[model samples]
Target: MRIAILGATSQIAKDLILSFAAHSQHDLVLYARRPEVVSQWMNNIGLVDRYLVADFTAFSPAEHFDALLNFVGVGNPAQAAEMGASIFDVTLKYDDMALGYLHQHPDCRYIFLSSGAAYGASFDEPVNETTQASIAINNLQPQDWYGVAKLHAECRHRALAPLPIVDLRVFNYFSHTQDMEARFLITDIVRAIRDKTALKTSSDYIVRDYLHPADFYQLVRVLLAAPATNTALDCYSLAPIDKATLLTVMQDKFGLLYEIQHSGVAVNATGRKPNYFSKNKYPKEFGYYPSFSSINGICNEIEKYFMQDNLY
Candidate 1:
């Protein structure tokens, strides 16, 4: 299979490029905004045949691709600013290429990296592919701009479904490919622990599941190898998000302490477990139950990166 990957620079994207390039007998081509901005060895894990570069603002998919791993959405934080100017193109422009690429190569097996945001507000119950979308069309005015962008990307994938498209509304994923600049809580915690800083979290922590990079990659490989398998499980979580009360557990376990500011309101995220993701199919599909999820996998990265002298 000849594969083209857009936005091969994200932690998730970087991992996908490497994993696919390594295992599959496919000819791989990687693309990013700046040709060499991405680390040389990042996408070469599988030794892709080509590494093309182009700004998504000027994105145009190159021809002759058998499959596409479109993981191009950057969770820009500006969309929620009080006077935000909507620099959404820096993000939405990739949707242009993903849709166009699928249209151009009708036979291409396209995998659009959708998000758990598509579940919208139906989080009242366990979310499935059939759950009603929480947000209405174009009403993407959320503080978590990344979540909004993910919602938009999923919609685009839906528009191109007849073209062998596999849409995955993945939830929180943590791994080593993460950029130092990223503000994800797990990475932030790792950095704080490495540097020994106080972690200030909400009095009632937000409960979200986490997954290890390897497990996440395994799921991606299963989907890419079997693109026709529409088994769309709406969400993926490494740990049972139900126990997500506070990272104070993580903090205390790691010998770190912090302050918490609770909402002091009823029925809010004031130290409560939000939901749990159903994880049967993921195991059935990938043959690997995510053992090292958020509670463990995230800390694992810190252990690997920092525990050089038996610090754990």
Candidate 2:
């Protein structure tokens, strides 16, 4: 299969590319503003010749692809917060470019890496594909920009694109590529354990579900094979982990020397916490089941850090 990826600089995109590279039969066309940046990663996979250093808006593919994966835009929440409202403009610009291409090449399958934010900061309940998104346009905020733009892109793709495309809404995902300094829960734990520093956190009552690389591999493979239809699926593990439980595991299993103190309030930075982890309906729909449970996935990442020095 011939696959093309936009935003090749993104760490997640690189992970996906590496996963695809495991299958030598699959050819990849990687696009980025700076091709030199992804050169090392491509070389690592022995696919250096498969990259194209070009802007997404200007570059049109010379060869047809069986699938096109759009991983563009500022995905980091901290970065999105800095971008503020312009996030919408930047997101739609690239999305429209891809949509226009789909109009020209309706046969190609398009897969967008969306986020749980696209569900509009729902704290009320666990969101699934069937859940209705809740975005408050009148009371827009910087935090909401990323989710709003993602939701907008999903809507636009479904309504405007001539062909059916897949939008995978990622709730929480962790891998070796995860930025250690980032304020994510897993990274915080990793840092605390490594540094032997007392981990300071907000309330540990919040619930989060994480996606493993193995699960991601299965998901992409299933999506590539399944006939496209305008649909969105949540990317989550079969198991959900609570913040407190994760901390407990770290303390007991890894001998983490950290003092866990809560601020006594559960402040929803993005929105209210989902009552439950997003449902894993992708398996039922596409026959792609996740391999790692929350504990196993976390342990695997930590083990990589300790043994291989591939610290996240």
lDDT of each: 0.58, 0.74
**lDDT tens digits, residue span 74-160, model 2:** 645556666778877777877776776777888888888888888784556677656777778798766777788888888887785
| Top lDDT prediction, candidate number | 2
Cα lDDT, model 1, residue 124:
47
TM-score of each: 0.76, 0.90
- lDDT of candidate 1 over 120-202, digit per residue (tens): 55354556444565555575444435445666666666655466777666666766556534455565566566567775554
The TM-score of predicted model 1 comes to 0.76
Residue pairs of candidate 2 with colliding backbone atoms: 123-272
